[model samples]
Target: MAHRALVVRGGWDGHRPIEASDLFLPFLERSGYDVRIESSPAVYADAETMAETDLIVQCITMGEITHEEVSGLRDAVAAGTGFTGWHGGIADSFRASADYLQLVGGQFAAHPGRAPEPSGEPRDDANFLDHVIELTDLGRTHPVTQGLDDFAITTEQYWVLHDDLIDVLATTTHPVRPWHPWRRPLTSPAVWTRDWGAGRIVVTTPGHDPEVLDDPNVRTVIERGMLWATRTASAS
Candidate 1:
């Protein structure tokens, strides 16, 4: 039977959830996945639906998830359903739910180049910029990142609050920007993987713009990550 996948997308429109998700739909379909796309978080609350799913691809950013919704999704992942997503869609999602944050293993703390003014004023400057991504030894060896070289991409460099239990795949240094308060360069994980119960989770911190998703390297990483995650789910 074909693997079943659920793609939940919505929340902040700045991430271009629909466009980003759409970019990968053809790939998923051609890979023999029975993909279902939903715009509502309520889909997460359906226990029967969750139980039947082999993978969950989420693109909801900075949104709220209910107790029931989180519980159902958590149970599915814990029972060996694969979960994968990129950028704010995964890391910056569900700001109010610690349970959801803990399951994903990271939360967006800040991006170094821009910060709110001390006087609580918003700046008109661009938040996204270019940076180099260096793969770790683990990333070089992992299936998701194997055969890939260090690449530079222009996007939001997400600085995340993450769990140490995760396997770091790739990272980038925070460039010294005038808005940043730190005096030195700080490295942040750009991609990672973790296990929850019998399931697998993969996160990539690029893809802030639709064009970023179109990058061949970025698409390769995501495609391999999804396949790896789906395989894990099937094995479970």
Candidate 2:
């Protein structure tokens, strides 16, 4: 059977969720996934309908999934489906849903005023020559970031707070912005993967803009990550 992908997207427009959702179509097609794109969150609510799905690619941010929807998604993944997404799409989704957070293994508490400065001087919301992260001890040997060197991108380097259970892939040291008074720099995980029962989940925090997705290296790694998180047995 051909592998399948269900891309359910919607939420904050600032992320250009639909456009972001569409970015994966060609990649999935090349990887042999029959992809379906949905513009709403109802995909999360339907159980029997989503059961046979081979992978779930979410782009929903800061939205709530109904209990029925959440339950169905969990059951589907536990039965061996894959789940993958990036940034606020997966990591920061459904703030009120603890079960969702526990399953995905992380949450977006704060970008730490990274979004806006106090004086309102628009920092590069897109690619800023900003420092990218160095792969930490746990990240160096991980499949998601193995052989990957420290590279800089002209994008917002994410600062994430992650759970202890996740296998980290890559990370960056974000310096304190003028918006933040504390001025202490912090190391943040930029990518990670975790298992949810029989399911595989891969999450990356680097894709905040289309250009980031356009980067050959970033695109290659993320495309591989999504495929890696799915049921593409023939892919390798």
Candidate 3:
């Protein structure tokens, strides 16, 4: 039987949640998963549905999730369902819930707010700036970044607080224009993975927008990461 994948997306229209979720449908289909896209977080309500899924790809940002729903998904993943997402879709989601943050491993603390554009408008476009990501001490070699070179991306170089629990995959040390308020040059992580019970979880800090996901390298890395994070990797 083909594996089932659920994509839940909504919150923060600027991230183009619906469009972002749509971008991955073909990839998942090509990978032989029956992909379902839903804009509502209520997808979390169906306990049987969660149990049936092989993976959950979420693009939700700063959205609400109910207590029962959150618990249901948590239990499902712990019981062996994979979980993965990119950028603000996962890292910056569920800011109000500590349990969610604990599961995901990072939170949106700040973005010094990007520098201004030529039109004198602040380029708040998170995925338009090309920057380098330096690998963390723990990221020299890992499944998600094992053979990858230092890549340049138009996406936001995510400077995140180190979560001791996660295994760093790749990082960027070069300072880009700050998007957060308190500014000082700081090296930042770009990708990482963690384990939740019998399941695997991977989060990429790239893919801030549709265009970023279009990068061949970025797209390939995330696609592979999703597959690796899911439980059916050996079968795939």
Top model by lDDT, which number? 1
Where does model 1 exceed 4 Å of error? Answer: 114-125, 231-235
Per-residue alpha-carbon lDDT of candidate 3 for residues 44-153, written as tens digits (9 for 90 to 100): 77898888888999999888888777887788778778899998899888788777888877776655445656687554463355677656655556666666677776
In order, candidate lDDTs are 0.87, 0.76, 0.78
Per-residue accuracy of model 2 over 188-236 as CA lDDT, tens digit each: 7778888877788898887776767777667766787877788544321
lDDT string for model 1 (91-156, tens) is: 999999999999989888987655556788666545666789899999999999999999988777
Poorest 10 consecutive residues by lDDT, candidate 1: 227-236
What value of lDDT does candidate 1 attain over all alpha carbons? 0.87
Q: List the lowest-lDDT window of 10 residues for candidate 2.
A: 124-133
lDDT of 2 at 13: 81
